[model samples]
Target: MINKIGKITIYVNDQEEAKKFWTEKVGFVVKFEQEMAPGMKWLEVGPSEEEFTTFVLYNKEAMKAQNPSVSVGHPSILLSTTDVEKAYEEMKENGVEVGKLMAMPYGKMFSFNDQDGNNYLLREDK
Candidate 1:
């Protein structure tokens, strides 16, 4: 039987920079980190220590070299927040590239980019 989401893999150019962006800018915590191999590391980060799912920041070049069949692309991740405006403002103040907030019948949402330029949506459900 299927359970909840385990982890999401995000291939990045620089693991350290990505880690800083997620932890410092995006306010994610480092759940786990270890050296998988020489010049390769396995890093897991999430919103909090108690969170179930995490984002695994993998070394893109190393991963691609190890697995040629690996598919690396931008993933549309929708993050829920209690206040979309506040989240957007915080992200912008933290120097994160953010898109304009949009209002929809469902909720208010905005998009922000990580250091690696991967865009993620933040929504405040009404």
Candidate 2:
């Protein structure tokens, strides 16, 4: 009964800043954005128009208040890239904090941190 992954929520201190980081720094496009409530806004961003899954940038404080049991910690996300070296260099040029590229049995990969200090893995599938 399971189809495909829909969306992943990323709780951030400032939604606007997160959006900028993803779009400007990470090179993702804004899929959707709208005012959900008085103080809350819904924002969805992804790598491309055809991408099935997207990241929803939500307000951290608002989410925590809405559901105390919900985990607000950073989620580990792994992204695929066509060229690990190019991706790594681009991220570094964009001022993103990234780790050195490593060679694994599977492929080449690296880690980078977003503005919220959330770490994400970038790998070139072999």
Candidate 3:
């Protein structure tokens, strides 16, 4: 049986930017790195508050499972943060395009897109 959403793979056009944004800016640790396939690179960023990791794959074969060629679907990915405002402001200051904070019936959320145009929703943890 499936245990949980193990990992989310995010395809990136720029490895350097993705590494910087997910690591330095978002506070995720770089789990590992190596050559994914000939010219492609593999860098996995671990979740700051959880036991999950997001893969930054470049090779076509590695990204093949993400269907229709999209690694994610609607709402793409949801990352939990302690402070949505601070996270939003920090990302914005870094020239990362993000949406304004909005209060939902569940919690606060702000959207942002990665270097690959993959959308992500950042929510505050209760």
Most lDDT-accurate candidate: 2
Ranking by lDDT: 2, 1, 3
lDDT of 1 at 61: 84
Write model 1 residue lDDT over 17-123, tens digit each, in one string.
Answer: 99999999989999999997778789999999999999999888887788889888867788888988988888998999999999998899998888888888899
Q: Which candidate is the best by TM-score?
A: 2
Task: Give the per-residue lDDT of model 2 (tens digit) for 7-96.
Answer: 999999999999999999989999999998899999999999999899999999999899999999988889998899999999999999
**CA shift of 122, model 3, Å:** 0.5
Cα-based lDDT for every prediction: 0.90, 0.94, 0.72
Model 3 clash pairs are none
For candidate 1, give the lDDT: 0.90
> Could you give me the TM-score of model 1 versus the true structure?
0.95
Considering summed lDDT, which 10 consecutive residues are worst modelled in model 1? 70-79
Model 2: CA > 4 A from native: none
